[model samples]
Target: MINPPALTLRRRSEELFNSAERERPHKEDSAALLLFYAVECGLKSIYMLRNNLRSTDDERANAQSARSFSHNIVNLMIALNISRVSIRPAPPIVIARSGLSGHPLVLHEAWRYGEKVKDANTIYDWLASLIDWCRKNR
Candidate 1:
């Protein structure tokens, strides 16, 4: 049987996060990239499920509403109609960028290059936790 896109995305997100958490050499960048993807996909998956969407195609067909929010985590949470307090770990988007102090997760595409995140462990932990919570709630 085919799994739903939400499940698929969450699963992949978990897999990548696990790999990133291992901290292997030369893998940090890719891991970070995937980790961000994991969160993005996880959020989208939940959003799609809540919006009565089933497949990626379903999301694509509604691209304006579904695909558009894939990049920014802050927007995804808002589009999901989720309040800041409702989300655990208080996603980076909700955190003050000044506090993050150059953390890539706060900046657009900064996390793509693990070096920019500064505290990858914290970001990873937060993202992993967020994905877990979002997936469970969805």
Candidate 2:
């Protein structure tokens, strides 16, 4: 039986982030959604690597009931015990909107629903920093 490595998610996240970067000039809204997924996958990779959940079997066997692998990047970051001070800071709007699950920095729900993200470039840089952090930590 072949099992997938935890780093697979990191690779996919990087691909998505890079694609988003290329699309940013022509399609900012699309890029925003891609950034959300990139952040989500990066955070998950961090969780999987940290917990040794390398395969589905490993995850099933060792998964903690309290931890969730959801699209909420904030919760995933919390689960991974990431230090906020280590990464670049999010813009003021993102910080103020952090509590909302639908916020662009949190998830893709806002972009999917056709809502425009304010300070999107700042958010993009923050997410890119997060992906970089994941790469370093993983």
Candidate 3:
């Protein structure tokens, strides 16, 4: 498990929030992005568990628990921010497809403004770029 620097997390979060504000015109998009960001943070917490847990079993359990908790958090955030619409379960594929490999924090921004992103590339290319950026910046 790798511990991303605190500065990186703060910068990533700020960037995501700023980007979401700029690109998210629809309420649903904004909600989705917010939810995605919460999930990303939750995942980070789970990732951190790997460093402290003693056994693989504990690590796996922690990861699953963190994901469940994050899902709930996302739902709550969505409900709070965007009223009048029931939160829908987004498939993992859809969430994963949104170029979230690196800087998981970017998932929020992407969720909100991914459609506006004009960089045309295969999913692999997009993911690769994100991973590279994470490595360089981290």
* Candidate number achieving the greatest TM-score relative to the actual structure: 2
**Candidates 1 and 2, the one with greater lDDT:** 2
lDDT of 3 by residue, 30-135 (tens): 5345434533443333333433433222334323323333434334233224222232322232344544343333444564555422222232233333223333
Q: Identify the superior model by TM-score, candidate 1 or candidate 2.
A: 2
Off by over 4 Å in 1: 1-4, 24-30, 57-64, 86-108, 113-115
Expressed as tens digits, the lDDT of each residue in 30-122 for candidate 2 is: 887887788887777777777777652365565542125556677777777778897888664432234342343443766777666677778
Sort order, TM-score high to low? 2, 1, 3
On lDDT, the stronger of 2 and 3 is 2
Clash pairs (backbone) in predicted model 3: none
Please give the CA lDDT of all the candidate structures: 0.61, 0.70, 0.38
What order do you get sorting by lDDT, best first? 2, 1, 3
Alpha-carbon runs more than 4 Å astray in model 3: 1-3, 26-31, 38-138
Candidate 1 has its poorest 10 consecutive residues by lDDT at 90-99
Residue 31's C-alpha lDDT in candidate 2? 88
Residue clash pairs of candidate 2: none
Question: What is residue 81's positional error in candidate 3, in angstroms?
Answer: 20
Give residue 31's lDDT in candidate 3 (0 to 100). Answer: 38
lDDT of 1 by residue, 71-98 (tens): 7776776677666555555424322333
